[model samples]
Target: MLYFLKHKLVLLATPKTGSTALEQALAPLADMVLQGDPRIKHCTFQRYKWRMEKFIQIFEDEPPQTAALIRHPEDWLGSWFRFRHGSWLNGTTRSTRGLSFDQFVDGYLAEPQPAFAAVGQQARFLTHPKTGETVTHLYRYDAMSEFVAFLGQRLATTITLGRLNVSPEKELRLDPALRSRLEQRYAEDYALYDMALDKHPG
Candidate 1:
């Protein structure tokens, strides 16, 4: 995530949403750049605001306007599966080498998910911890050009993002029943994605 002091904007790093690539392009220009641990780098908008309270009170005088990117629910989960299945995780519990896309979705919907499918929910990640609110601005992962354009206008600078940390190519053909279960279980994710779409309807 990056904070632009001059613009009072906070760019949240939503996992599997090209955040690392944008970070590379924008970090040098940010007032504060949060990196390292995934938890910190992908900090929720609410937590970021709370964490920066003292800084805002002392310097900026108010919390920054926050924004985040989100992918389709199925696509996000598929990315997690493919990423774990990559050769880099060869012998780890996080590897999905022997699992099918259907099995991965089952594990994701399991009461106690296996490490390979235990990635956190996108909706929960974007929600405010206390107020149950969400980000001030939301962008679709598939509509990156729109997102970059919005950011360019807001920050008054061109943003040139590049591919980074891409998951390996994998065919995600989920079983009909299992896909239904996933959609039902994670309905909130789709709901939020739809909400974002409404914001920038084409």
Candidate 2:
């Protein structure tokens, strides 16, 4: 996560959603940055509400405005599948090597997801557990230009981002039935992504 003390902006890092690029692009301008640890770097809005915001309120009347990016649910899971399918992890149980995209998603839908498909949901990461509140602003993962422009305007600096944490290329297709199941199981993520796209149609 990256926070700009002067701008009062907090950019929450949603996993696999260009967060690494944002961190690298904004770190030089940010007052504080949390990285290296998943729990810290990917801290959700709910955690920020009770912990970080509580502390920030000690010095300011209001907490910083929070923003995050959300990806299409299928694309998000595809990224995870290809990332773990890299040759370096071929022999590990965590690897998705040799597994079809459908199988990987099936693992995700399992009651107890296997290690390979245990990625957390974007909707869950962005929502407040108690109040059901999400971030103040949400950008679409596929719409990088809009997000970049917003950052430039808010931070008063031109921003550039390099691709980072890119997953391997793979054909990610699912049967119609499997996709229907995915949509049924992860409807909230789809809805949230649609909302973000509508908000920032870049």
Q: Kindly report which residue stretches of model 1 are placed more than 4 angstroms away from their true locations once superposed.
A: 198-202
**Stretches of candidate 2 exceeding 4 Å from the true structure:** 198-202
Model 1 C-alpha lDDT per residue in residues 1-202, reported as the tens digit of each score: 8888899888999999999999998898898889989988988766766776457557876767888999999999999999999899999999999999998899999989988889999988888767878888898898888888888888999999888999999778989999889889999899989888424544
> Which residue pairs collide, candidate 1?
none
lDDT of candidate 2? Answer: 0.88
Assess every candidate by TM-score. 0.94, 0.95
lDDT of 2 by residue, 1-202 (tens): 8888889999999999999999998999988788998999999888888898887777778789998899989999999999999988888889998899989999999999999889999998999867889998898987878888888889999998998989988888887888999999999889888888434444
Spell out the clash pairs found in candidate 2: none
| lDDT per model vs. reference | 0.86, 0.88
Clashes of each: 0, 0
